[model samples]
Target: MATISEQNASSISPVIRLHRSDDVVIARSQLVGGTVLQEEGVTVSGLVPPGHKIAVRAIGQGQPVRRYGQIIGFASRPIAPGEHVHTHNLAMGEFQRDYAFCADAKPTRVADGNATFDGIVRPDGRVATRNYIGILTSVNCSATVARAIADRFRRDIHPEALGAYPNIDGVVALTHGVGCAVDAEGEALEILQRTLGGYVVHPNFAAVLVIGLGCETNQIARLVEKQHLEALVSTGRLSTYNIQETGGTVKSIERGVELVQGLLAKANDARREPVPASHLVVGLQCGGSDGYSGISANPALGAAVDLLVAHGGTAILSETPEIYGAEHLLTRRALNAQVAEKLVARIRWWEDYCARNHASLDNNPSAGNKAGGLTTILEKSLGAVAKGGTTNLVDVYEYAQPVHAKGFVFMDTPGYDPISATGQVAGGANLICFTTGRGSAYGCAPTPSLKIATNEALWQRQQDDMDLNCGPILAGTKTIEEVGAELFQLMLQVASGQRSRSEIHGYGQNEFVPWQIGAIT
Candidate 1:
């Protein structure tokens, strides 16, 4: 009788060939002292450390390095057949290239017929997946008052579906780290102002009340002057107030709560009505990832993102640092080669950025990531890009800028989740979808966030925080496609007024971190 193949059927058969013409394999697990890998009836190589690569053939300098069927890097030196290939001999190719914007983002004509989610219709003609009353602080001095106002509501009342406003969600107070002691004309001021302005005008918010101490540099009046919002809430009109103009904290809190209550009454009149899927903007992000992240959550999320795009919605893939190694895959799919080149340029910029700061892009895969089995940033990045799916690269955006592209687009941001999600939120993401392999307690203000867990143990351990468990893929229970679709469904529910664990626990707002890029001096 033929011997049963000893290769464990449930274990991920190591992808030994990424390109048909290539011959290198990544180690799936740590090898015993003298393990040998056999491929195509030939001994390809001996045991290699997990996450390291070994060649079955020779490569020369300038030759492309392939992984996951994509160009991950290039050979920096000559290598004999069957030699180990890694950082010592490979590096990202730095090149100059032209960028084309919107050239390849050919206005996609979305499929006219598609299912619509029940959503909150905004007076701005923008369909919103959420209906929230936002209490915004213009400066840190107002942070306490803002939180106090929210507390009054959360502690005092359980929302009863108000007539005509059955869709109204609870109150949220958004406070942040900045808004004090910054240059008035610098990028920080502009970003801080725009972010505040953007949230005030956000479709997800039905009512917004500004709270501030008045003298702070991030003046509410300037925000009013800039956005021409003297006529605030022109559509389904509601109360707009500022605390500084009020006598003091006690009066401001009382007045803010009254205004919030009235707005809640008005917002409660709204009911979820059917709207096209295109109204949804999902922010795709990955953090606390491991070796299995790319193989599981990221790709699974990518598949879900593609499905959302197919249904005529939007998906934003962010975190500039995380995109480092796999930018080539994104470049090829660039709406145009120029858009492709733009992405390539960003990748190149990050290289010098890290080098100058005396840091290494590979310095990531933090202690947590390493403990969870990730070996390098390249390994992490290759997994992170899987969340964007196989969609054509449609557009690239700078930090926190508006994204009007209909399909998948890239947003520039640091790998830090708070700041990254903050930018994505300002860029018009209605909902943030985050995947974590080692489990992260991440949240986004104004916009709702749904967390997808990478491993089952982590999911079960943190069931109160995790919204979706992707560990089934590792447990021989489910496929990436199925879990992905399930996640998409959960996203729709959250968009349509279902409270995620984060929302229920009020875990957002505190996480808003703008990418601060200057010296304090």
Candidate 2:
């Protein structure tokens, strides 16, 4: 894909052609009927919304439509040049994907020197971007009690609550709606336990508390045993209590408060020290995306990921469902056949999972995404994969599994934003870099989230929620590399304690959603 500047250099083009062979071009702005696309040598046949597609050439019914030099979908009907092409004319179709493993894998270009950040170093040599006391629940029944305990220490509600513990970020309670109805030996239980375990040992948390209902199937003891959290419990860094065992909700809340208070001093003992950028682990995500997502923010973020990997840091690209048709892109860049096969296996699993549920992978480009000019899953997937950057896929992981490999990697996760990001955080991402063109308001606790706007209009409309703007790339004022370098610096600053817009608004606490699988009964 040509940079926006290069595409618009001669004269400001009203539409953007991602590839010379693309059947459609994205409207740079609203183009009224009869408007002339001088460069494409076509006159607009009808009104086209900003960021929407306009056919660049004639296409026959059942013919594949290309974008980004890849097939996005097939033309459902004959499409005339200059005509608007969207769901009404474009549809999903089956096609063969060439999974030539390691075909494009290349050695990483290491940066000259390591970048540094002011980070909190744990006694065990782990690094943290923020310090907080986390309260986790094993079942829905203990949610209220956990919230009550965290409410008492709300800095916004009571400014003086943490007067003495300046180092502590804040107290947060991460609760879920399911736990009791799940099978004790099922995948759902295992996922929940793994997610909870990740939080207990997350470096951002100085200490953690687990609350549970004594009679629930998701027993606290089993969770501890399964996740191997006994070490944290033994060291007093993790504490667990049951509402039923504690006698009632009131007693549970009181005990929880007391436990948190006792840990404040120890949590406050954490002090910031200089740490290498190699310690940074970022989770890559994009939500409420639009046409400019691939054109601007996604690729720009990918560039930043390349820079991060060059510095020996790690970046995790997840949302397996969102990357449905794009898996082959990552597979070819895999470090070896084993890594490539792992990614392909996940894709196959999703295919069967969707088939069992009577669903299709094409059931994406949600209403919001369609409204933003995305037409099919293939189109969206092509854009989504751009956030991973051009790098060899070092490893692949199941949902919520710990990420031990450094450099760009993939994780199997659903398309839902909250659940997908939840898995990423559980996999040891200390920070999140999220790209959005439709202005999604999201955050992940324990791990700070940085929002990047994909277009100028969104940046202007949602400036308060956005941390950085890649809009300049869309406006032809900046290149992807330029914005990417800027984003990399911002990552270091945020990792060093500079609060993102979402953090300032306290958006993380309510966004904890673990991926739920298996039967409720």
Most TM-score-accurate candidate? 2
Q: Write the per-residue lDDT of candidate 2 for residues 66-87, one digit (tens) a residue.
A: 9888999999999999999999
List TM-score per model, in order. 0.82, 0.98
Q: Could you tell me the lDDT of residue 495 within candidate 2?
A: 99
lDDT of each: 0.72, 0.91
Model 1 residue runs over 4 Å out of place are 1-66, 69-113, 155-166, 233-244, 344-360, 475-477, 519-521
For model 1, residues 176-209, the per-residue Cα lDDT tens digits are: 7667688877877787777777777778888788
Q: Report how far off residue 214 is in candidate 1 (Å).
A: 1.4
